[model samples]
Target: APQIGPFSMSDGPANSGDMVSTSCSIVKGDFPVEILWLHNGEPIDQGNQDITITKINKHMSAISIESVAARHAGEYTCIAKNRAGNVSHSTSLTVN
Candidate 1:
């Protein structure tokens, strides 16, 4: 479930034989924000999968899509949550 707050994310289009970059947008949250990424309803994060958070700020974030491939296609959810509230969004990734 996508948390609540000020947070957003996106994985750039399939590299198409090259690495791709994903960008995120954050609006405003009541408190701090936590970003959680899920693929096919599965937790995807550092030290676990081939995903990494490249940049994160007060209201925005960007991620790098590495080794783009066909199997790397799915849904990505960005959940932002804090002591105040929580929010979430999702995007689709297609590699061909």
Candidate 2:
């Protein structure tokens, strides 16, 4: 399996702080594909962010980031897990 996420994060506003939403995707299965976000190397919480997913196929899924801010700028990942095993991937964010 292949894990992909974070994709990219872009800064918002020149003199003010704003949200920097991003997105990620992965494969779907009978198990859960854990889409996790990290800020400054810390794991993000579900209440702080909304994780989106869709059944692209028997083994495919999707995710999204909304109202992301500078604090939300960091590495994001998606862990696809099943009875077989698990796989994960991450990406970085830059708010400048």
TM-score of each: 0.71, 0.51
Best by TM-score: 1
Question: Residue-wise lDDT of candidate 2 within 1-96, one digit each (tens)?
Answer: 444533554443322254344555554444455444455556555554343344454344444445444554556555566565666666566544
Quote model 1's TM-score.
0.71
Clashing residue pairs in all predictions, respectively, total: 7, 4
Error of 2 at 46 (Å): 2.2
Give candidate 1's error at residue 71 in angstroms: 1.7
Give the clashing residue pairs of candidate 1, or none. Answer: 3-86, 3-87, 4-86, 4-87, 5-86, 5-87, 12-22
**lDDT for each of the candidates?**
0.62, 0.49
lDDT of 1 at 3: 33
